[model samples]
Target: MLKAMVLRNIKLYFKDKGMFFTSLITPAILLVLYATFLGNVYRDSFTSNLPDGFSLSQKLIDGTVGAQLISSILAVSCVTVPFCSNMLMVQDKITGARKDLTISPVSSAVLSGSYFLGAAVSSLLVCFTALALCLGYVRTIGWFFSGKDILLLSADIVLLVLFGTALSSMVHFFLSTQGQISAVGTLVSAGYGFLCGAYMPISSFGSGLQKVLSFLPSTYMTSLVRNHAMRGALAQMEADGVPKVFVDATRESLDCTVEFAGKTVTIPAMYAYVGGMVLVLLGAYLAVQYLAERKRIYS
Candidate 1:
C-alpha cells in the first residue's frame, strides 16, 4: 500500500509537464546568466588580485569559475526544486484528493509518508540531471574532478535532497491553497540563494549578517558543495606555481572554507550541521502529523 501510494504521487508529479519543467527554471536561468556575462565576472575576480607578471592559464581559470557556478546551482536547486516537487501535498488538499484518501484503508501515516518520499525521489531525479549537465559543461571548459570528488559530490546531493524534502514537507503541511504555495515558492526561489550564500559569498556581507547566515543549514550545505567542486581547481593553481597565500585567500573568498563567529568551520562540521537539521525537521514533521491526527479524531 505504501509503495503504491508513493508511485502514484511520483506519477502525478511527472505527468504534469508544466510542473516538471517549472521545477528546473531556477537552474536554467542561472545557466543562461552565466553564459551571457556571469562567466566573465567570475574570471575577472580570479585575476583581479594577482601580483604583477603572475599569470594563470585561461583553462584553469575557466575550470575554477565553472565549478563555483555549478556548485551554486546545485545548492539552490536542492531547495527550489523540492519546493516545486512537494506541491503535490498542497494540490491534494486543494482538490479534495486527500479527503478521498482518508476514506480508504490506507492510514494517514502511510499517506503522509508517501508524500514525503515522493517529493524526495522526484527532487533527487531533477537534481541529479542538473548535476550531470553541469559536470558535462565543466568537462568542456577543463575537467579537474577526480573519481573520489564525483563520489563525494553524489553523496552531498543525496544529503541536501533529504534536507530539502523534510524542510519543504513541514512548510507544505500548513499551505492549503495553490495561491499560498505559489507565493511561497516564488519567495523562496528569489531569496534563498542570496540567504544561503549561493548568489554572493557570505564573506562579502557585514560581520553581523555573516554570523546570522552561519546559523542556517542551507549556508553550510552550500559551503560543502563549493568545497568539493573547487578542490581540484585550487590544487591545480598551486601546482601551476601560484603562491600558497593566494590559493588560501581564494578558497576563503569563494567560501570553500566558511567562518562562523571568527572561527573556520571544518568540513565535518558542515556535514554534521546539515545532517542534524534534517533529523530535526523530520521529527518536527512527524510531530505535526500526530497532532493533526489527534485533532481529526476529536473533531
Candidate 2:
C-alpha cells in the first residue's frame, strides 16, 4: 500500500507538464546565465590581480566558472526539490482525492508517510538530475570532479535532499491550498539565489544580513558545495605555485569557509549543521502531524 501511494505521486508529477518544467527551469537558467555573464567578470578580476608572469589566467577562469556553476547547482537543488515535493500534498487537498483515502481504513500515519516518502523520493531524483546537469556544466569549463569529489557531492545531495523534504513537509501542513503553495513556491524559487548566497558571496553581505542568512540551509549549502567543487581549482592553483596570500584571498572571496560568531565553520561543521537541520525540521513535521491528528479526532 505504501509503495502504491509513492508510485502514484511520482507518476502524477511527471504527468503534469508545467510542474515538470518548473523543477528544472529556474536552476538551469541560473546556471547558464551566471556562468556566462558573471563568471568572466570574476575571472577577469581574479586574473588581473595576479602579479605579472602568471600564465594561469585561462585555467583560473575555468576554475572560477566551475565554482560559479557549483553555486548555481546548490541554489537550483535546494529550491527545485522542495518546490516540487510539496505539490503532492497540495494536489491531494485541492482535488479532494485525499478525502476519500482519509475516510478509508488507512491510518493517517500511512497516508502521511506515503505522501512524505513519495515526495522525498521524487526530490532525490530531481536533485540527482540537477547534479548530473551540473556535472555536465562543470565539464564544459575544462574541469571534472574526481571520484572522491563525486562521492562527496553525492553525500551533499543526500543531506540537502533530506532537508528539502523535511522543509516541504513542515511547511505544507500549514498550507491547505494550491494557490498558497504556488505563491510561496514562486517567491522562494525567485528569491533563493539572493537569500542563499548563490548570486553573491556571503562575505559581501552586511553583518546583519549575514547573521540572518547564516541560519538558512541555503547559506550553508552554498558554502559546502563551493568548498568541495572548487577543490580541484584550488589544488591546481596550489600546484602552479600561486602565492599563499592570493589563494587565501580567493577562498575568502568565494565564501568557502564561512565564519559565524567569530568561528570558522569548516566543511565538516557545515555538513553537521545541514544534517542537524534535517533532523530538527523532520521532528517538527512529525509533531505537527501528531497535533493535527489529535485535533481531528477531538473535533
| Cα lDDT of model 1 by residue, 148-198, tens digit | 888889889999999999999999999998789989998998999899898
lDDT of 2 at 196: 74
- In angstroms, how far off is 41's CA in candidate 2? 2.6
Instruction: Give the TM-score (vs. native) of candidate 2.
Output: 0.93
Instruction: Report backbone clashes per prediction.
Output: 0, 0
Best by TM-score: 1
- Per-residue accuracy of model 2 over 1-299 as CA lDDT, tens digit each: 88888788888877786766677665677677767787777777777777688767575668666766665566557655666766878788888888887788877777777777777777777777777877887777667457887787777777777787888888887887867988878777777677777777878899998888777777888777777787778877877898878888888877787888888888888888888888998888888887887788799
* Residue pairs that clash (backbone atoms under 3 angstroms), model 1: none
